[model samples]
Target chain A: MIEEETNSRREFLEKSIVGGLTALSAASLFSSCHGDDVKETGEKVKLLSPDGTIVEVDSAYINTNIPELHLSEHNIREGVPGKKFVMVIDLSRCKNARKCKEGCSKMHFLPKERSYVKVEKMQDSEMAAPYWMPMTCFHCDNPPCTKVCPVDATYKLSDGIVSIDNNRCIGCRFCMVACPYSARIFNWGEELYGLNDAEAKAIPDHDACSSHKLGTVEKCDFCPQMGEKNELPDCVKACPNGVFYFGNEYDDAVTNGDETLQLSELLKTKAAFRYLEELGTKPRVYYLPPVNRLFPFKDSEESKNS
Target chain B: MESDFKKEHEKLLDLTKELMPQKFGRTGVIWVISLVVIIAIGLVAYIHQLSKGLIITDMRDYSSWGIYISNFVFFVAISLVGSLISAILKLTHAGWRTPLTRIAEVIAVSAIAFAGLTIIVDMGRPDRMINLFIHGRIQSPIIWDVLVVTTYLVISTLLLFIPLVPDIALCRETGVNPSFWNKKIFKFLSLNWKGKKSQFFLVHKSIRILAVLIIPVALGIHTVTSWLFATTFRSGWDSTNFGAYFVSGAFMLGAGAVIAAMFLIRRQYKLENHITDAHFDKMGKLLVLLSLVYLYFNINEYLVPAYKMKHGEAEHLNDLFTGHFSLMFWSVQFFGMILPIFVLISKKGRKPLPAFLISIMVIIGAWFKRFLIVTPTLLHPFVPIQNVPDAWKSYNPTWEEWSIAFATLAGACLLMTIFIRVFPIIPIWETAEERGIIVDTHEEK
Candidate 1:
């Protein structure tokens, strides 16, 4: 389900970017490069060209020419349809093999290539043994960020995902401070990413992309865009051992990219937990206990790509 | 020049005009220049902050607010001076506040203006400042701050302006020799006042009404500002004592600023006769009283926490008492609060020069005190600041933040400087009447 959602987001963004460019500019960029019969076969279109004049171009450019825009403009207030998402990371699965971080960073196109997920080494005191705890946005039920926004720019969707309306976000960052989990990161400069200037220029609108701007607030989008691809989330797919499960709460099923299991059975069997449960954040993500270790605790080469 | 054989009174008028805020001479020119330079630097920094994002500041998720907030509180606190001198003194029937009124009024206007501006600078999206109104939520304390501070500024400026009409008329009418622009401005602003009986009655009634109204608004401004923090769930910030604590601290700061202004006008403009050693002595006593009230609140704010030491409050106090913030915390307590009280408690120390120096110390120290109050508690919130780098856990303001904060202060001074150049810093007619010889009730009667 997550992979299916991620794939759809890519397709929707690409369609918009190509459709968003007026016929005039497409003619200039592609007139000499592509064929004329392609231009004649589609709907009559009016577009503003690169030089400020109007021109006509083939509608085929919509599909054959442009790559998909990753940011899809579905009324964000109305969440992704058909699935209510959740994640279960069984801490007992392994040590600090940070493959999850590497995959997340690459997929998100983050700088220093870091994403919302972080691997924190934890110990209660000098005598306690240190453990590696991976962190992600809890995507809370009672989100503090939504409560304080002077403009209702950040909101919680009906599907139980907390989302930000990037275009409307005034960059106040009050939400970041209010969040106890430290789940947000700011884009502090223009993006350095996989796309070329044309692709970057055609990147989805504030409503389109999960990452907004240098002046604005950003964090994880729960790989909702990637979830549409009918594949596991980057982190889940990247973990060599089946430690992460991506699923839908309503569907009652979860998959770790290798095998599928019922969400309730997994939690009941593993005695799953959530971080900082005292705060009443009601996180969508849950974690299973590390009592039965899957791998010996060690800081391995897992974090290399994250 | 030859009209009076009274050397002291004649010398006093010269001193008043000279010290009454003359046109910017060389030192004044340099002073204005520096303030402008600082404001320019701060403006550039703010623009950078807007373009690149708030990440330019050291403020992480943990310590979200920094010096900008503290400076804003300092400005709001200082603005309370208008209410203290203009209303409280009038209510108490103090006969000797005549010459000090203009300085206090100007300080009030300037501080409030900066107070309003500084809050915007702290906002992450100053460009979208209008959103405060468009999407204002009553649940938030920031809206209350916006409403109250603006009301206070308008009332204070009016209180400063309405009383100055007769004085501006006096400067215009008695202009045996006045500068061209001064003569022109005085003529325009005076509204051809004949000092009629009806006019005096109406003016007096209006001034009386404003005096009564401003007292509550003054209290409201600082209290509402305090509520901005107190309304939050943060440990050190959540306190019922916050309102009164803020008001008392404001009174001390405003009094300190007023006395310091009085001393500068007395020495530089040589208004020794008009603003006497006696006035300083009285002001010193007043400062001592205000300091005591503030001290009482300080104990309430700190001692209760130290005693019960609520889990979160305990961590916060450790920072102020002997941890990261110990140096600033102790210095602020001593110079901002304790030492001023000790100095003014003695008769000899209440003399003009010493009192003035102590008041200046109190003002400077109080500014830093505000800085400490805002930044430290936020850094020490209940949660251990984790996951981020070490710098995120600790806060040390970058030079950009410092420069921006200082620039706001300088801008306030520069605004006052321009105002002084345009208007008399003392109410000439009011002071003359207060001294003795009453003007005839009719035009040239």
Candidate 2:
């Protein structure tokens, strides 16, 4: 009986994969010809909402609100369940081109002066090589920032993402002080010039958890919102050199938008290490040390003097 | 010889009449009006801050906390003087502490009140202050501070009020004829004090219990404040010595503030017989002792860390010892600690005028020391600051920040001044008892 159930489930998944692809194509093709003529067919199909409620709707209206459904605030804090997400950055591929920073700023609608992700030009010692280091919130298992928040406004979720609830945050900025990486940035006042309110409201909060109020602290959320739909984070997609790889640790697979690799093999082969590992924060983000350079390190305007 | 004793008895009555809470003269009115104006300006600036957020202040991501925090420390330090003079000195049976106790308690009550207010001013969302109670976790140092500060304030007020009961009765019986409102207040506050044996026993016993209670709570308030910084992994704040360091420094400043208050009260009210040069001499000796203890902690706070020159401590120590903060740092060390210690240590220096000057120096130094403690360490976080505006890399509190911080100081002083105007700066009942006055039962009002 168990074998029979498993066989039926596998067969249903296989059939749905084929049917779903065709449905996607048909929706895309017919969406442009919207005059209510498609509704005259009176054909209804069963569909499941993102929150798992099934409804019988005409096929044309099926995918209209699909984008908005995945970006719910409830799921933003709950995060992508059963998945321990992680990121790895290849230092060799980075040559001081700040596209990742730019992409982060753009996706989060951050002010030019304040970007959640900082690209630091680091040199370990006088004798060591200087390299461009892109630093964002490591989303550590033991996040000191969340530990210090008086209101539990910033919290580490079960699925390996540390996020802030701006609505509940009392703007004490203790988290900013607690962060060793200096990854957190405070919205000091009203950000009037960047994304307007309507534009911000239109973009679902889960995209990067972007809409922030003055006095709240903001940091990179690792784009779990993007992870919900199997899409790469904006920074991973934006990097011209494919410097960032993001994936699920449970699945043991990671991707840099263009290529997917086995997580264990890549980390072991590349000798990847987490930043400030001795601090014992246990950051999910890893880095492949700058060995065998793809391009020579060039000092960008963001790079400060050693 | 018998006539001489009667003359001394008459002199004591005259002292009571003189020490009654008098109406403020023209100069007092001017002083109060100026403080009110300053506070009004601060309120306006705070309104602006509320509308604009904390952006008006120079605090940024790097320098997340600034003068508001330091000002908070200063108020908490000054408030500790109340506990020191009233509770600690009383417990130790120090005779000279009687005249200074009321002044110290007044300072404690006002400074702690403003300390609570100043912290709220520092909070980014004052509106969500209730959340402190709703979601307050015991693990956070902030919750500890709130618990202790509130506890200290209540105890400190009771400490002040319980002793004032007999003084209020004295005011009513001596026919000082205070204002109608003042009379009603004193009448209600006096609690029908006939000064019977049982009442005296109950009041003294309650005071003794509170005095013992306040010592731990006072120590807790400053210790928790130090923990707010020390709990962080930042280099300068990451010290095992911070709690003792803060407590020691607080006692030194508290003593300095009490000396200043004593000098002013003696000079202003002309209470030479009550608050004599001997009082100043004893306080000066106490000041010297506290300063030496604080200076010892200062060495431990800075020198021991500098000796090893660890990776994180190197830059922060360098900044204080020789870098941009060096000028302010050296001045605070010399004027705040060293000069005051030297001046107060000598027999000639312990005179009223000289001791007052040294106490002023110590108080000023203590203020700047708090600023140094809060700002410099924050500028040098564990991670090197990068990719930020030049302004964020450094902090200089703007005019609004300055106005609000100074207003809290002025407000504390204003509260103390009003308190003095309402009640005798010296405890009349204690003073009379010390002078061995006979107590008549059921005295006519």
Candidate 3:
């Protein structure tokens, strides 16, 4: 069955390679013939809308909207103005469900085994009870990774997001060694994700979260592309138990899709703390201690297999 | 008095004849061929790596650096020999250093040159190496390393070349049965030296200046290399004594390398008179001193940390002391440091054969020592390794990494071999001058 699946995948890739070329020429030809009159066939078809609802639409109404390009390279380096993004993970609610990991991998187009966020089982001592902690890039205010980068490939932006410019990364991996939390991941080889080079390049740079260059470093980017539209990151939206809360520190407001709370008040009430806070990295991500847990801790399937 | 003068002139002639560069014999030809073959294989592996990525090596996200980086550190460590022998000894007026200075400089140039190349091989994107200069941040220790390594290379090349000018002039004048092309190369490189008193004075002045200038630069190179690790927050790497630790270790490795080269060159060229047993004995003493200094630093670096056994450091120390890497760790310490000190401290062991064997052991041990320093620290990171594939937790270099690493070693040897083939390994003019046989250049012309 696995061999058969691989054979079909290879066949699909081969067809796409050929079909992609034809589509490029056809697109140009259709653009050149734009002034020609169109005659509606008066046909209706069932289609899946963006919201996953079935809809019957006239053929004339069915048109593809090209994805809008946002954030030039310079603009990405500058980051979103007047915003300081932060995150607070509520450890009490987390029970290793792993929906956040799944949603993050799906949104980023990563493979099943690779993920930006990992849910780990943590026990302070042998006698203490274990709890599930979902770990992601802390995006420290004083990022050690950026300081050790030989080239200015990784940098801290004014908006509190630590960003990487893969185009400029020399792939020395010094930044990886310098990161105390092991937040960075290296692209040791090609990560095509089923798209050919040209097809991958066709996606806009800001929106193509998973089209990572070979031999560069990548990590959780806080879903800045979605931030432009004032939407939450995929992991924040995917958690059923509201384990993750993301917000703007400047506005002092944070949300977990189900409720919004004052960031400072919540932190003070919960006695939140950053991981390895003594390192003086000043991480933007905070974690509330797992007190009065809502769900019992259980090992994840992935953890069990390992 | 007249007969004494003629005798001195004839002795100078014999000295030049004995010291001139000779054509390669059967063994030399085989050595060159083997090095070239190794280099060719390495080139093939590097090209494959370029087309693919660093995935050809055993490195992963957690164990991000492997043998290539360790090899780079070894080269950098060995290159420090040039500064130690030529600069420090020369400044101290150690007159017996004449025969070994050129050898030390050649080793430095070749080792450092390959040191730079090995780093590029370790990089995931070698093609984007230009970005290091284009977008270089001065704050990065890597940039400081690059700057200092380049500076040391230039100064070392000059230190090698300037003193060789009078020697090259001798090679040009005597011809030495060199091929036509070699004759031209020698004549051009000689820079029209008349060996006048003024010329000798100028050479000595320049040599003195470079010898003095290279000391701090040499220290900078190794200290900055140490900072590459020390500046990081990793438990094993973070320490105040790292700079002194690396510098002292580099000196020991450098001395070992020089002793090994001295023995081989003495055997190959049949220059028993020039590189005598006394040189070996003195070098043995020097190696013992350096090894002891390095051992002292090693204790300071490891013992204090082991005693405390901080939260994250306990796991790393145990892994070295009694865990998975215990074998390699103990072997490197004993063979690379303790055993060498024990063997070289005795008069019998300071003989050419035993010293050579022990130096070879030191070299091999030094290579693995670097590996121990780099790989183990990475395996035990601050956070526990979990949720990833088990393979990512431990590092084992593949055949490609080994091949490429050996190639860099072979490449450094090949460079030195070619250098010895072209230029006199022992400076002929300087040797004669030291023996008080100052022949008149104008009268000979």
Candidate 4:
């Protein structure tokens, strides 16, 4: 009755049709794809995994793409797909492994001299217990940084990640002054860390800092490009302890690349919290408490060299 | 002062140069040479910094700003002197300002020029500086600052230059005619200053225009600069008093710098009769007024925060008052604000040398005060300082930053030094006109 339409390789990669992609990830736990579990009809629709691999699946599959993942970089600057992003970091679980810091720095090619995501040692009082707390870009809804930037160098993405367009940064350091979280960093000279050329090849050229010229401000982008590959963020996967759960709140689910959990359920169960909540930053990264310390803080004066 | 004034306008007294717009003698030469050497060191250090990066400076992510910002603020603040002592006094018809006006204008033009350049030095990415214009977001206060500062620079410069046309023309009448290279500049600059009634009217009108234009821009320049910090969400920076604070401090520093420059010009050029002790006393009194106003704002800036001690303000205040930066903060407050105000309040302390020293204190204090304003707040943000290294939590300036900062300071000095050598630091025609000693050959009619 209907003219048989050839399923496209491109359409198969689209989020709406990329379900039943069990060959790629269980991240696609959408129910539409699950209903076909009884019918072993590998109707063979082409698919791409978050890990840079391609696959084929049936046309009736559902999509598991995070809502924020679908928006373009321009759209991200405008804000998340439907709702504003916010996070509450629980003060219990952070021992400052700096996995998030390392992942962000590696992604941004931040100079060795500066750390955009710092793990600050916090002691409420001299008598209070000391904890290693990880700090990051708050991705403020009313970002003080974007407010002070002389040029429109930094902006809020639609996915609620505050990103810097380094090419436009005038390097006034006024943003640095304006930022209470100290998430922004200035490129004082050359891109001394030497951008990883190979990292770009792993994705497209659009994903690398090398394409951008030197002398710009840079910080965490939360690895949104990795989302383009339909994969979890580097920090969420690299933390051997599973300290971070990178996810979308729209679906109320989060995963650490290995274990998946309900976002609201995890926050309620673990007592999650946010940093500088009073400042009204509306940060996007939540934390669990540091009640269980996995490792003793190897504390020494951390100099810029370290 | 009386003896020096007696010999100021006559033949050279031993070492002093008696030439009109005067020649530099040995003291001036050595002074200039020292500034050049200092500037050279700063230049070399800057080159090294350019190669090595801002890593040469101890300023880390925590103390992202350092003396460079403070120094730049100092330059901006001190530049206000050009308007306060020159245009404002002229507008009010204060006759005693004749000797001080040149010094005030020189300080204003020189400091503002350095302010313009020094801001670029504070940039972490100087190479991408054009971004301020290409993608400038009007919503950002920094764009407003860039625009306002640029406008103020143009206005401040014209305020200095327009009034000097007649004096520069008088110099052109002598062997001081610009060389072939400078002739074009001198010719264009002179623009037919034959001292006709019409010419005087036009010049007077232009000067009035610039004087009027400069006042608001001067206030805007410093107020906007203050907004650069106040608009931020930091504890120390989130104060309503900042604009007034900055304006007060700017006028104080500018007045101090003017007094110091005027004293130096009078002493070196043997202009005691021209400059006079009366000029010093008046400047000293005005410096006191500025100092008192600055003190009031400083108290407001400090005491108001201290009294209420808002959630995070305590640590920042303690850091300035009794903690890490207490000593430096107290020193600046004492020397920059308190002592100078006290010194100039007394008649005898307003004497040339005493006032000169007080002015020096004001300049030095105001400079270090900027450092306190920029650094301490950053050191104590809302959250606890952590991560990375202990050094990262604290602040320390590296030698490279110091060298570059000091070099810019010296470069400012050298600019003033060279400027004095070529142009008359005193307004000769205005002084001659005031004395009713016109040299026009057309008087025979």
Best by lDDT: 3
Name the regions of candidate 4 deviating beyond 4 angstroms.
A1-88, A95-116, A124-132, A187-214, A257-273, A287-306, B1-19, B174-185, B436-445
* Cα lDDT computed for each candidate against the true fold: 0.74, 0.83, 0.85, 0.71
Residue B376 miss distance in model 4 (angstroms): 1.9
Error of 1 at B154 (Å): 1.6
Q: TM-score of predicted model 4? A: 0.82
Q: What is the DockQ of each candidate?
A: 0.16, 0.47, 0.50, 0.41
| Candidate with better TM-score, 2 vs 4 | 2
Q: How displaced is residue A129 in candidate 4, in Å? A: 4.4
**Per-residue lDDT over A211-279 for candidate 2, one digit per residue giving the tens place of the 0 to 100 score:** 577777788988877886677888888899988999999899999988999999999999999988887
- Compose the digit string of candidate 3's lDDT tens values, residues B159-277: 99999998888777675677889888888998998777778888989999999999999999999999989999998899999999999999999999999999988888999999999
- Tens-digit lDDT string for candidate 1 (B299-388): 999998899987668888998999988998999899888999998999998998889889889988988888787778777654455545
What is the TM-score (0 to 1) of chain A in model 1?
0.69
Q: Which CAPRI category fits model 3?
A: medium
Can you list the residue pairs that collide in candidate 3?
none
Could you give candidate 4's per-residue lDDT for residues A1-306 as a string of tens digits?
111222332333354334432333334433354343545455656645644567665555545553443334434345434333334444455656667666765655554444456777766677767776666676777787877776777777666777776656666677777877777666554545555666434533335322244445666566666654446766566555666666766767777766778888888888777667777766677778777666664554652233
Single out the weakest 10-residue window by summed lDDT for candidate 3 chain A: A25-34
Tens digit of per-residue lDDT, candidate 2, span B1-445: 5566556546556667978877777778898999998898888889999999998899998999899999999999889998999999999999789989999999999999999999999888888888888887777777788999999999999999999997787777677766798889989988998866677778889999999999999999999989888888888898889999999999999999988988887777778988899999999999899999999999999999899999888999999999999999999999999998888888999999999998999999999999999999889876678877788899999999999998898899999999988888898767877877643333245
Q: For every model shown, what is its TM-score relative to the native structure?
A: 0.78, 0.89, 0.89, 0.82
**Candidate 4 lDDT for residue A146:** 76
Q: What digit string (tens of lDDT, one per residue) describes model 3 on residues A70-121?
A: 5452277777665799999999999887889899877776666777887878
Which wins on TM-score, candidate 1 or candidate 2? Answer: 2
